[model samples]
Target: MKRRNFIYLTGVGAAAAMLPAIPVFGKEISPEQALEHIDPAAKKIMSDVALNAARSKGATYTDVRIGRYLNQYVVTREDKVENIVNTESYGIGIRVISNGSWGFAATDKLDKDSIAKAAELAVTIAKENARLLREPVKLAPQKGYGEVSWKAPIEKNTFEVPVKEKVDLLLAVNDAALKGGADYINSILFAVNEQKYFASTDGSYIDQDIHRIWPTFFITKIDKESGKFETRNALSAPTGKGYEYLNARPEDKIQTASGTLYKGRYDMLEDAKQAARQVGEKMKAKSVEPGKYDLVLDPSHLWLTIHESCGHPTELDRVLGYEANYAGTSFLTLDKWESKKFNYGSKEVNITADKTEVGSLGAVGYDDEGVKCGKWDIIKDGILVNYQAIRDQAHILGLNASQGCCYADNWSSVQFQRMANISLQPGKVKLSIADQIKNVEKGIYIVGDGSFSIDQQRYNFQFGGQLYYEIKAGKIVGMLKDVAYQANTQEFWNSCVAICDQSDYRLGGSFFDGKGQPGQVSAVSHGSATTRFNKVNVINTARKI
Candidate 1:
């Protein structure tokens, strides 16, 4: 998390350099050594040593996090593998509240002597910072569970699976695209396992093992005569699962008019074939006539919308301007939340912030600060109900406990408020994706996430998609090209006319949701059903460009 020089993704492309564009950094480790678990008893002794040092140094409160972070990425283009990276970062981070100020320090050294040194340094920094403090930090009381543990519900550890298996799968995906007529293809598989141990002076010792996976690709087709090209991205979603997620199962597949949908499990090869065909069709799709029309949005597309428009804005830190350094402040200002009557959407709109939903990227038994995870409504009956908060911010909301949303992307990074799995609750009425599509008139049906733009305040926005179909008089007429929708956050959600029933609910996620000034990336998810929004303005992105 503290890399001074690191490469960021320039953009998505099916045809680019022969090698992969991004790099993974952490302590280096071989693939075979990746999934080894840390010893909890050893971690507890380290925690005690650090705690004694901090208390001896006049620190009143302290918490220690010992973590081993592991990540593997496999990249391939066409027939050959481009890059296979395996990274591991191991360290201890200590945070302390002394002299009415908060300070943090981390070190890769795991010995008692080194950890004690880090602990003392944290207290020293806190005392120095106390000189400029105007008010003492106010942390809500927490009840330690004594000693506890949690692990991601995964049947097969992707890290334990042979590297050859991952490589073979990605290569097969690329070959399927080529056989389906894609001019070029690039595929990637990313996996992560976080082994963490948390202990605090408040009397808690918590150990957790977490896992996450993402398999994605970009496929392109070019019309040589016109020298114009189009691209389609794989519809596979990142999930909090294991290698089993890569396995294809008929029971877990949802086949709809939008093509094949997946839940719990995914079929990368099948999806690649669909991506090849779709990108080809995209090249010949009709150009849209820009105007206001209803929009039928698949969960894949709507999830990003929810993440930007609702999830970011409702974060208590963002609304309070604590996150203004990078992601900017919120449009749903604190005053609006206090009113508790601000209409954020229609009566059909019910958004939630959940840290306990199984198979969700943000799902955890307890957050980093040792608060138990739970769920709460963010928007209910179309009204702003709550903002995501941690122990320090809970007082502002007159809450007795933290909302349990605090997190740190790595051991060396200090934990802070991060977005949980923010989702739009499914409609109570019995409605299906097909049923929702049948009601749209003169609209565009969109699938898969694409380019998006939003104001610093998370208000006005524009979004695109991987595939678009013209919907006329309750029927999908034909594929459309060069389409994007423009709307304000509140206006768009208020325009929600319908949301499909729970049966249609599905998840969409991001592996790199970046926030804060120094910047840390967290994986989170957004769940939704096929939803209909009325009379949203459509634009021709190609014409504008």
Candidate 2:
């Protein structure tokens, strides 16, 4: 039995006390209440037909995932010019296993006929693939769940905000950057609100809502004499929130907040100009020599390092080669699960996979398979400890239950194992970025993520950053251009000599993270503190190119 279900079934009172907001097992929900948000009749028909269809088809395992996604986009070049785009999509995907092979099918139309056809197609595909099956599927055991509903934290729905207002905000930011001496400026802001419902044969049902937003702007400076261009961007973190995010002023009062926050009335434009000047300086900065050097990496750049090296490789499915075609395989093979000490970093390096973090893009109360999300360690005391797993993957690994990592982007995409918010646990000392740098005699300080390349095995990699600064004699000298750092996964982490405390941590992420055979996109966040690596190779990107 799953620990949660066991707790609920054995001690209802304790469970209720533990989760006061969650509905107890066998609790009745009126049809009227359920119908207010979703179509009860349609849901019941779809669930019943999926179960019967899977059983009649002689499939060993099957599940149905339904997703509804709504998205809005607003773009602006400068001034009052703007463009707005909106979309709504929903569909159902059926996944089945037969004769030790897997198959999937999806359809946008949700009716009895379509649902049945999808299920039949899924089983048929599985049967065809079964002929070439190599190894039989083994699922980790999990307690069956009947029904569950979860809502991600959000203040207001982005859709509820007016379209014109969103555009105006983008224009305002563009104007701000342009006024700051930017020869050209471009800006875009968008939001995605998704509603997902899932049901499986093993008696699991889940309903969840997730929200995400990305607001970005770029300012380009041109040298009239040399025709050289330099670009800078505002660092606005993505969040699981609504339109209120755009107007989140620490202290201000305005009835019509549209386009007001981004306006250059405060320090926003000044900061943009400063960043642009820095970028311009970089165009003439000296190239860094390739050699072993001490370095300080800000959270912006460190996030991607952690993503490629730690996040993808730690996925149980990717390590097992189930996700080889899309996201690539992992170096952390199954044999190293518990025995291998994956020397990730110094003793201060602790990492975790969490889906319950508030305001995180990957934050979900319950995963697609109705598994309650929580925290689990990926690395503890510089040693590899666990891998991110979905229900089926967990079963194969002999885990009694999943860590709630299963997810699908939309109804059409089959649920594949996905990433949560993989984060580095902070150090004990409250060391600031300055403090870490003060300790370095000669090094570089890197900020913001740039282009990156990694091997298919995710072992060797090189990463560039948006901003680079030279540290000479324990102090920042100036900016540096064409900078990139290269290191092997183990070698890089092993070189970690220092790390900042929790106070220096920040969250970073990608809006469209791709994975799976047919291609599915998910949004995930990575949070980390500023960190320092010792005796790492730094190269001039211009020379390498």
**What is the clash count for each candidate, in the order shown?**
0, 3
Overall local distance difference test of candidate 2: 0.71
TM-score of each: 0.97, 0.85
lDDT of 2 by residue, 1-545 (tens): 01111111111211112111111111123322222355544665686687678768978877787776666666556574444555556677888888888888987768888888888888899999989887877666555577777787677777676667767666666666666567766566667777777777777777777888877666667778966666666555567766666655534211110111121012334445555556567667788877777989877678889989989899888888877776789898877766767576667778899999887789988777667789999988888888999876776667888888888776766677898899987778888777877888878888777779999778999998877778877788777877899999888888887888866667777776778766667789888888999888998767332
Off by over 4 Å in 1: 1-14, 17-23
The residue pairs found clashing in candidate 2 are: 139-395, 140-395, 140-396
Worst 10 residues of 1 by lDDT: 3-12
lDDT (CA) per prediction: 0.89, 0.71
Off by over 4 Å in 2: 1-41, 80-82, 98-101, 248-274, 543-545
